[model samples]
Target: MKYSIIISFLLLTVCLTAFGQEKQSRKSKNPNSAAAEKGLIKVSVMYPFAEGKTFNMEYYETKHMPMVAGFLGSNLVKYTIEKGLASGIPNQPLPYMAVGTFYVKSLDEYQAAIAPNRDAIRADFANYTNVAPVILVSEVVR
Candidate 1:
């Protein structure tokens, strides 16, 4: 666990340094790039890893996400699903079991669509994952 923590910190630091430099350089070249992305928002639903948590990737990928996309329709620009493999160290448990994200054109539109079907969405959660989802809503920077 200690080794995993150390590796996580090292990997995070390296990634942040490289990512910051790249974004800074690109922003300098195109000052309006960030401004253009201001209207877009990202909604991430993350399922944290736990010893007994269960995730049905097959259902999440083939059914759950598709239903979400269908609900959002034109409001959603794109959506993606990710499966966790490692936690920065070899043989270490993953930090998250799965993550799903939506890049939406309009937050208000997305909310409007989601509000009506929220119950159905929540109800379906049990069909794919037993772990509760952590939600994050953020404006796109670039």
Candidate 2:
């Protein structure tokens, strides 16, 4: 009888603790709630290399990206550049030479920043790859 009571008490305590933690988590606000509410925007640029095309990784890394950073400044929350290695299929060439993802607080902020520097950014493309980049802008839902 005593062992049964003790086990029951322990189980009750554990349940209560778990309940409390769950309640707290639900009450707590997400750190990115404000950004989520406003909606986060991601800009992706894909450069696909084909026959006779070229990619200047050195110039892109050293000059183009730095210029982009300078132009975006604080508005650019974060950005990533990925060099394509190989396709999922063995012995297959990568479809894209490079991909760039830019995270911003909002579409408006991105537009504002890019609007002023669009010409300069476009011009810098000639210094890098000959392939025309495919650009996509998407909202981050999760």
* Pairs that clash in candidate 2: none
In order of appearance, the predictions have TM-scores of 0.74, 0.69
Specify the highest-lDDT model's number: 1
RMSD each, Å: 4.2, 13.8
lDDT of 1 by residue, 68-98 (tens): 9999998887889999987864456799999
Off by over 4 Å in 2: 1-39
Q: Write the per-residue lDDT of candidate 2 for residues 47-120, one digit (tens) a residue.
A: 98687889988888788887887777787877888888866444457789888888787678778888989999
Structure candidate 1, residue pairs in collision: none
Q: Which 10-residue window of candidate 1 scores lowest in summed lDDT?
A: 84-93
